[model samples]
Target: MRWMKQYGRGDNFCGYYRLLHETFRIESNIERFREEFENLYPCNNSGKIGDITESYFVWEEEGDDTSELIYSVYQNNRILYKTVDPLRLLPFLEWHLNNTTLAKLDNYLQVHAGVIAKNGKGIILPASTEGGKTTLIIGLMMRGFKYLSDEVALIDPRTHNIFSFPKNLCLKEGAFNLFDPLRIGIQSKEYYVRSSKGRVCFINPERITPNAIGCPCEVAFLIFPHYNPSNPLELKKISKSEAVLNMAKRLLNLPYFQGEWLDILVELAKKAECYNISVNNLPDTVELISHLVEER
Candidate 1:
């Protein structure tokens, strides 16, 4: 994809790319996205015209209705996705870019899981949207666990270790009020917005825990978390074989079954203790996990 003018560039574990565009109005939104994501893709330079850094177009002419603005994403001249709603633009870009990053990482395995580590021991919360994964991630962060990832969990298949894939936490409007520190003691309207997921806010992890970014750590436990406000917190041991099959189903960009990668994943599951936890109290859940991490 070619554009007359380039505004910004991004590069990280994913890939290096320039965001090129001509419109100032859409450029401003791109700037906001760049501000949020550039830290993860900390390239401070823009690519030259036609330079072939993975490129994308966020073009909406000035005075155009925001709802009608259509955007296209291209990598190496191949159009990946396009949509009419501007609300999906940022997240669409993020989700694809993250997957793109994982695809290029031959040595790493990516899972649809939230991970948090402490003192070189890591816990994997294997969950999907139904599991309240983000809420549990925030609750653990409040209790002082280093933030690894709220979405994708990167694993070194060879070492059975997990690393962080940090991104802004997208909090549902309802959960925003439950966590006081996340709210910063003020109204959430300033940072809130609507998306395909409904009302949400993007939170910088640094605000809650400085240097909370997680490092590679041994995969000590595989935890499946569920949140139910009316129930008591409960943790029950699960079969490693069951954990392997279940967590394997959560692989986002891993190789197919019967492959070497599949064997590696099974090995990872076998090495770690697995459990299912129902969390009614965030504090109790945190305390329980903290003890697990602290124990021999």
Candidate 2:
């Protein structure tokens, strides 16, 4: 329970404390932790600190072997995660920060989707993890679409404008080979082994394109993407009603909007072109989306 180092920014912060004995292994990985989250929240070394609101504490267990380092993450005195691999902690921490931020955003309609923009029009790709949202986002970015987020789409309920959440893109091992031709340098980055996603890497979206971060823009299209390697690429135009239903399923903060959730989603669906795309190959899928965006 004795914390050796603390990292803080504004109200949300996390600190790493040592249990039993101090380890140099934990100290060495601090730089990597900062780099992983630098874009979202530039953590400042606050030396040592006491309890604070909305903070996460990472407890490192004492071990003779550095390779066998173990850690547990706690929030509000409750254990959130326990891991033998230090790299796995980054994703869990990132997820906590995102959810913590999203919880305070009562005004915005948050949807579990990937958002990117082109020509001042925002495109929302609504899908869950391992559903190819991040892969499609990276492919779209390579084709000149700007990156807003690879995870959540924060939409202004009144205006239907999607704001930039621009956290680093998390790529699972399965999508690593897909971007090799682009030479985005995925091979050099450190990979984390997650229980569900296997190997994962975080890459800044800017690596794909200069000034890749996009601005808030009106919803122009809602593309629901499904990845199936065995199937041929298929694109089908869907009705606004269908789009609303699909989006509603992925909406993260529905209760935050109270009774206005349905109305907000309906307006968003009405304003944007909706399509369901079944994707097999990355090149063909990107090409099809490029044409779709250009024709709009």
Best model per lDDT: 2
List where candidate 2 sits over 4 angstroms from the true fold.
1-59, 63-68, 74-79, 181-189
Lowest-sum lDDT 10-residue window in model 1: 18-27
Across 1-296, the per-residue lDDT of candidate 1 in tens digits comes to 42112323333222244221110111223444455455334343444455542455553333356544455555456766665544455666655655555555546777889998877778899987757777788888888888888887888866868877776676765676668755531263323334556656666677778887778888888999878888878889999888888788888766432376677777887878899998887668878988877884
| Candidate 2 structure lDDT | 0.75
Q: How well is each residue in 70-154 modelled by candidate 2, as lDDT tens digits?
A: 6777766788898766767777876665666566666889899999999999999998787999999999998999999998998
Query: What pairs collide in candidate 2?
Result: none
Report the Cα lDDT for residue 255, model 2: 73
Backbone clashes counted, model 1: 0
Question: What is the C-alpha local distance difference test score of candidate 1?
Answer: 0.66
Q: How far is candidate 2 from the true structure (C-alpha RMSD, Å)?
A: 7.7
